[model samples]
Target: MSHDVDVLALENQVCFALAVASRSVIALYRPVLDPLGLTHPQYLVMLALWQQEPRSVKDLGAALQLEPATLSPLLKRLEASGLVDRRRSAADERRLDVTLTDAGRNLRSTAESIPQTMIEQLGMPIPELQALQSALTAIIAAATRTSELTGEASDE
Candidate 1:
């Protein structure tokens, strides 16, 4: 047996674990967000809008680490759902602004419990989850910095 055997193990791959964990966690939100007419990505967009509205598409893309092409469709879907309005900015006709509609603002109340429900379903203590979040944030920052240095910001 080689000394690098452990390093080459599938279970030891961070990307593999992260990918599976992300998919699994997102799946947990499926049933919960279905009633709200949101997919996990759409739900994330709503969360950002709930925090601050009238943001430009560029701003949302940057905040969500999403590419413009990827975010455009999600915004269109949200607009069609009556949860948001996508309009040309009055100040800048070239820019698209995303704002919550009355329905979108009202949906906030219903979404308020989703996080807690997700936590309960995961059955993890809040402190542990918080720590996990912190670690993930650090990983993201490191990856972002690496990408900046390498000129390879997230391919997607």
Candidate 2:
């Protein structure tokens, strides 16, 4: 009974810890991203674009693990910011392609420092951070598999 009670404690809950940690870590990005005129989600979109331009919305959504409905508004905002241009694919009119504009491409040079800045701010060594990322990825995969097995819908 004591074990069960202790297990039920909020502090012992993985979900609670993850939720708090996620919020806290994202908060750290605000000051850094504000100067870049990006929200965390917007920054993620730009990161993907910086890696490869002319990505289809479907591909971007998959790469970002976001649904089309969620990705659409982000893309729209980026387009409005003149950081990206969305147009129909020439090979497939039904497909929309997102390409970084010149300004967006230029912004990458400035954004390059963000990773080092974040590392310094976090005060964690690269190896530790990489391990944490690996663990988190495994957790995500396990949670996804559980959701699938149980037929539960997950936005993530």
Candidate 3:
């Protein structure tokens, strides 16, 4: 049988494409982020914090689409690196808040070029990249809705 006609062909699978693309694109950031002393996940956390300061752990989790268990270690590592500070929220002692240290704030300047760098690396024009991003976002929303409808827990 031709591979094109095989329903189970790995190359025909959307998940396979997405998984490979995710890994490949993240790999591109590895070298750039190394000098900043950040792993991909930690970089995501910093992005959220850089957008807004003193966000609660819950808020950060929501923004990053990560569960607390997964996010905790990242926060701990960022704190250890002196890039972030985590403290109990004064308004609500039970809640934890995260804020960037000056170092984390300064890192944003260096990171500002990353988007353009990745675009050049991918050799994709701005409009095409934007369209791809839009499509992927729609896919994510649809997948999340399907999971919710089926009462299935989303890995996202």
Instruction: Point out where model 2 deviates above 4 Å.
Output: 1-5
Give candidate 3 misplaced runs (Cα > 4 Å): 1-4
* lDDT tens per residue, model 3, 50-119: 8999999999999988999999999999999999999999899999999999998999999999889899
Per-residue lDDT for 1-156 in model 1, tens only? 578578878898999999999999999999999999899999999999999988999999999999998999999999999999999999999999999999999999999999999999999999999999999999999999989998996654
Candidate 2 lDDT over residue span 1-156, tens digit each: 565578878998999999998998999999999998899999999999999988999999989989999999999999999999999999999999999999999999999999999999999999999999999999989988898999986674
Q: Name the weakest run of 10 consecutive residues (lDDT summed) in model 2.
A: 1-10
Q: How many residue pairs clash in each candidate?
A: 0, 0, 0
What's the C-alpha lDDT at position 36 in model 2? 86
- Judge candidate 3 at residue 55 and give its lDDT: 96
Model 1: number of backbone collisions: 0
- Ordered from best to worst TM-score, the candidate numbers read 1, 3, 2
Cα deviation of 45, candidate 1, in Å = 0.3
Best by TM-score: 1
Clashes of 2: 0
